[model samples]
Target: MLTVMRHELNMQDRSFSTYLFGFFLLETIGIAAMIYNINNKMANFEYCLSTITLVFVLIIPLITMKSIAEERKLRTDQLLYSLPLSMWDIVLGKFFATLVNFMFPMVFIAVYPLLFKRYGNVYLLTSYGSIIAFIFLGAALIAIGMFVSSLTENQGIAAGISAVIIALNYYSLDLANITSSTKQGSLLVILFFILIIGFIVRSLTKSTLAGVILAALLAAITGIVYLIKSDLFEGLVPSVMSKISFFQRFYAFVNGNFDVTAIVYYVSMTAFFLFLCVQSLEKRRYN
Candidate 1:
């Protein structure tokens, strides 16, 4: 795993995209700092961080687009399979390598709170807390992008797919507000989500029966709850969207609240997606 990680990092070091990712990230933050800290004369560094949260949707896909795609394009994944490492090891190594690339820009970002502290009464503790959550949000999204990259051999497709998903997540709060809040609407939407989950499970396992069973089980449970307490279903869709959105959870930190559940949510999301990434490779190995 370490060998794979080092090799991946070395390869990224040579890629122009890697440098661009750093440059773009820093420039975006710099611009945000100017707007929030300089122009507005706000002492809250977290506001600057919050302003640039959407930047992840752009750069994350850029960095993770080629993670697994290039391997298959060059026919090198076969070499990975034939190697002694397990699927988990290979997936983890790639994830960590990309995570390191993500963090290179973040190290510079970490210094902003200190820089701002010199000028005024900056909320350093809140700023650091938000930064930590921001890192978790990036990790979870990187894992998601890596999984997306594993699905296609084209870097552009991987980037496109991941970017769309991230954009949806970034705008999820507004989407939730516009969505139907009625019990019936929530029930249908939740069922739709269950169906999507079923398809994802099918893709990962390559077993239609397993997917159907899982979907049916979840739908049945949800249906039973809806029937027993219809009020519980009211406004559930927005609540679900709010809970599921990566950016929505990040707002708790931006609002100066250190939410432990949000931290756990981000960690769980990262681990879940990494597990799926391993499963993606395992399916290819079997086929």
Candidate 2:
């Protein structure tokens, strides 16, 4: 794992991706700082972090697009499968390596609170708290991006899909507000989600029967529950969407709440996607 990590880091150093990521982070922070300076009424660093959060939809894909996709593209994944290291080791090594690369600029970001303090009254607790949340959010998104990369050998496709996924998550709160909250509406939306999940399962397992069976079972169960107790699903879609939203959870921290639940949610999300990445690689070995 360490060897893989070192190799990835060395590769990143030789490539432009790391530099591009750094430049984006620096530019985002600069813009945030400038905005804050112009509007002295907005003194919180969380505001700056919030302003830059959407940029992750673009920047994270740049770093993670090649993590596993490039390996597959070059047919080196077969060599990895032959190695004694488990899939977990490879996935984690790459994840941590990309995380380290992402963290390079974050070191500079961590100092922003002190700089704000030097200039005027700053809420250190909330500022640092938001920063912590921001890091975890980025880490979780990176994990998601890596999982997306594992799905495709083409880095461009991986990046595009990752960007779309992140963009959807970023705007999920607004989406939920606009979406129907009625029981029938929620049921239909959930059924649609189940179909999408089935497609993903079919793609990953390459088993139409497995995907059909899983989707049918889930859809049947959901249908039965909806028929039996329609009220149970009232406003369910929006509520669930808001709860699972990554940005919505982070806003708690930005609002000065050191929410333990949000931290756990981010950690859980990271672990879940990393596990999926491992499974995706393992599937390749079987194929």
Candidate 3:
């Protein structure tokens, strides 16, 4: 795993991908920080971090587009398949390789809070908390992107799909607001969500029967609850969506609360997606 990680990182650097990613990330964050802090004289560094996170909608796909997708496309996956390492090792190595690339720009970002503290009184707790959230968010998003990459050999397709999913995660709050708030509406939306989950399972596992069973069970339980207590479903979609909003959690830290739950949520999300990514790759090996 360590060897694979080093090789991946070395390849990324040699390809100029790392430099390009770091350059854009630094430039965008620098511009945002300058505008919000230097020009507007904003006291909180958290706002700058919050604003810069928007770049993930683009940067994540860029970073992960070729992680596994390119390997499959170039038939290098056969090399991976023949290697002595387990699927979990390969998946973890690739994940860390992508994460290391992601972390490089953050090293520069880490200095901003200190710079602000030098200038005047800065809320180090909130500033640091927001930064932590920002990195955690990136870690989770990269894991998602890696999963997307595993689904397709085409880098462009992987990138496009990742961009759309990340964009939805970023804007899910607004989408939830626009969706219906009635009990039936929430139940229907939840059913749709379950179907989507089942579809992903089917896609990864190539097992229609299992997917159908999972979807049917989820829909049945949801329907039973909705029928029993229709009023309980009211506004449930928005509540659930709000809870699922990735950006909103970071905002909590920006508001000066170091939310332990938010940190756990981010870490859980990262682990979940990475697990899925590994499974997706393992499926290919077995097939």
Candidate 4:
């Protein structure tokens, strides 16, 4: 694990994309600080983070696109399997290396609250809390991006898919708000997501029977439940979307609330996706 971490970090140090990712994040923070802190005379640095959340859509892919995709492209994943390391070690090493690289700019961003404190009232507690949660959110997304990378050999495809997923997650709450509150609408939405999950389960495990049975079982249960109590599904889709959205969780910190639940949610997401990543690699290892 240490060897993989060191190698990954060394590679990042020499990679142009690594520098570019830092440059872009730092630049976005600078601009956001200027707008929210200077022009608007806002004391809350968290506002800057809120405004710049969209940057992750691009940055997530920027770093994660090539993580596993490039390894597979060059057939280096086989080399990794032969190493005296478990899949957990390799996945965690890559994840921590990329996360450390991300934290480089965050170190500067952390100083912003202190710098602003000199000028006037800055809510350091909430400000720092938001920053911490932001890093957790980034950690979760980085894990997700790596899983996406593990699914493909082409960096561009991985990057594109990651960007789309980030964009959707970033706007999930907003999208949910606009979606129908009707039971029928909610049912449709639930069924749609179930179908997508079914396809995903099939692709990832390479088990059509497993996916089909799981999907069918869930659908049948949903149908029976709906028939018995249709009112239970009223606005269910929007509620689930709001609950599951990563960006929605971040808003609690922005609102001066140090939400422990959100932090736990982010950590859970990171772990779940990292587990999937290990499984993805395990599939290829045996093949």
Q: In angstroms, what RMSD does candidate 2 have relative to the true structure?
A: 1.7
TM-score of each: 0.93, 0.94, 0.93, 0.95
Q: Between candidates 1 and 3, which one is better according to lDDT?
A: 1
lDDT of 3 by residue, 64-97 (tens): 8899999999999999989898877888888899
Ranking by lDDT: 4, 1, 2, 3
Q: Count steric clashes of candidate 2.
A: 0
Deviation of model 2 at 148, angstroms: 0.7
Put down candidate 4 lDDT per residue, 69-147, tens digits, no spaces: 8999999998998888999999999999999999999999999999999998999999999999999999999999999
Worst 10 residues of 2 by lDDT: 34-43
Please, what are the lDDT tens digits per residue for candidate 1 over residues 15-48? 9888998998899999999998989999898887
lDDT, candidate 2, residue 87? 89
Candidate models: Cα lDDT each? 0.91, 0.90, 0.88, 0.93
TM-score, cand. 4 vs. native: 0.95
Better of 1 and 3 by TM-score: 3
Give the Cα error of residue 76 in candidate 1, in Å. Answer: 0.6
Off by over 4 Å in 4: 201-210
Question: Could you tell me which residue pairs clash in candidate 2?
Answer: none
lDDT of 4: 0.93
lDDT of 3: 0.88
| Ranked candidates, highest TM-score first | 4, 2, 3, 1
